[model samples]
Target: MNVRHQIKDYIEAQPELKRSDMQELHGIILGIMPDCKLWFLDGRDESGKVVSNPNIGYGVQALKYADGKTREFYQIGMSANTTGISVYIMGIKDKKYLAEKYGKRIGQASVTGYCIKFRALRNIDVDILVDAMRYGVEKTRV
Candidate 1:
């Protein structure tokens, strides 16, 4: 329910994580975007109880992208895995189009027309991602 609990539960469910792993993941997240707004989402089952799924993850509001009319920016989604971490770009309207365009250049983990998933944080070109986010926010500003 709470962010910390959700994070803790997510970590614990993995079962194979070492203390150093946790620290490394946390540090990596913080290091990636120091000013990002972190939110803990409760992954729930069909009955609404908290559940675990590698697909479900946390989000960081990276930047507010907007133009004079549209106001939607990119919020980065991140998750921890047994081997490494995953980062995804969120808040896109044409996920399908973007996926098709960037899928080859940047790996597409998922594309439900909302979130553009990717691999580990280091795998992505951060400057390009940030610029895209900023442009999205600025382009969509109302």
Candidate 2:
């Protein structure tokens, strides 16, 4: 019932290949952010509808909405999707930074403003992914 347990269970519940990949990513993210806060989001809204895939998150960032509402969220987040995985690097001001700086070097991943999505870990460069994550965490510090 704890956040760590929830995150572990989520990763273990993935398909064989994705399970291993998720576990690997979990470990790598923890290694990069040793002692950082950990988070598990079941992808539900206030009404409990499943709006998105569950995510295992690392670090901390306070998100301010247009209505002046604020929510505390993770700086780096990972999730398993139908095709593969998504790693979200949140709070970057420039929407094109990730794509411009790491799109090609990151291999087959899709580098959006704050997300790097790929079919598998082998399809991308792990080092570059780590760099992007580090940047996100540092930039989004509260």
- By lDDT, the best candidate is 2
lDDT of 1: 0.49
Clashes of 1: 16
User: Given candidate 2, what's the lDDT at residue 135?
Assistant: 88
In the range 33-88, model 1's lDDT, one tens digit per residue, is 56554565454677988674333233333344475354323355545644454445
Q: Candidate 1: where is the Cα deviation over 4 Å?
A: 1-9, 15-29, 45-47, 50-74, 79-88, 107-112, 116-142
Q: Write the per-residue lDDT of candidate 2 for residues 1-142, one digit (tens) a residue.
A: 9999999899989999999998999899899889999999999988999999999889988898889998988899999999999999988989999999999899998889999999999999999999999888889988
Per candidate, the number of residue pairs that clash is 16, 0
Per-model TM values vs. the true structure: 0.45, 0.96
lDDT of each: 0.49, 0.92
Report the Cα lDDT for candidate 2. 0.92
Highest TM-score among the candidates is held by which one?
Answer: 2
Could you tell me which residue pairs clash in candidate 2? Answer: none
